[model samples]
Target: MQTVEHESFGSPTEIREFPHGHAEILNVGDATIGRLVLEPGWRWSNDVKPIAGTESCLAPHFQYHVQGRLGIRMDDGEEFIAGPGDVTSLPEGHDAWVVGDEQVIVVDWFGATDWAKEPAGNVAAHA
Candidate 1:
């Protein structure tokens, strides 16, 4: 067993950033944890879809909302808002965005590997 501590979202193995959002990825043991910060006016379609090359976000997520508010809209037209202290398990084929003026923070234990990743063969496209 081992222990790793940080004052905040520090010492990340990888960090993916877009125009209005960013994900700090930390590798611990066999898990990849992602700390996502979505600024106000950030929307998955407008911010991340081009990188992913998908109509909706294809990365499924199991995360904990840390602060602010986030809105989610599924492909089937289902929609909801997730706020602070909420635990969410979002499947693939969804769009998400920040709902308020505050930045939305989330810690995801799943789907961090490909979140915000530029599609294969399109490395310089989103850069």
Candidate 2:
């Protein structure tokens, strides 16, 4: 059995701000996952690949909208809106945001880029 906590994984002050919040990484089998706490203005956007299209894409993401809201859009012309208590599976192209100046926190789950690699640990805990 393995155990990890938010306190164990502090906010990355070098890259992001503090009190805006931090993350707790949980490793279970081959999954590399963590809970991301987004402050009222948290945002992340990356250049992407559309898997099967000539159009260069935005990354695909799946996030649980635990609190506040999130707005997502594509450069071409598609939009996805979300709010507290909402869970969404992001498609292959988009940008995301926190809604109305309210903080948006989510428990994010991601798998290793290579399926063969295993995560550091596999346990659950409260933050």
Worst 10 residues of 1 by lDDT: 118-127
Relative to the unseen true structure, what is the C-alpha lDDT of residue 46 in candidate 2, on a scale of 0 to 100? 22
How do the predictions measure up, each by TM-score?
0.88, 0.55
Stretches off by above 4 angstroms in model 2 are 1-23, 46-58, 111-127
Kindly list the per-residue Cα lDDT of model 1 for residues 1-127, writing each as its tens digit.
7776553467688889998989998877777889999999999999988787778887889999999999999999999999999999988889999997999999998988778877677442221
What is each predicted model's overall lDDT from 0 to 1? Answer: 0.86, 0.49
List, in order, the clash count of every candidate structure: 0, 1
Candidate 1: clashing residue pairs, number: 0
* Per-residue lDDT value at 39 in model 2: 70
Best-fitting candidate, scored by lDDT: 1
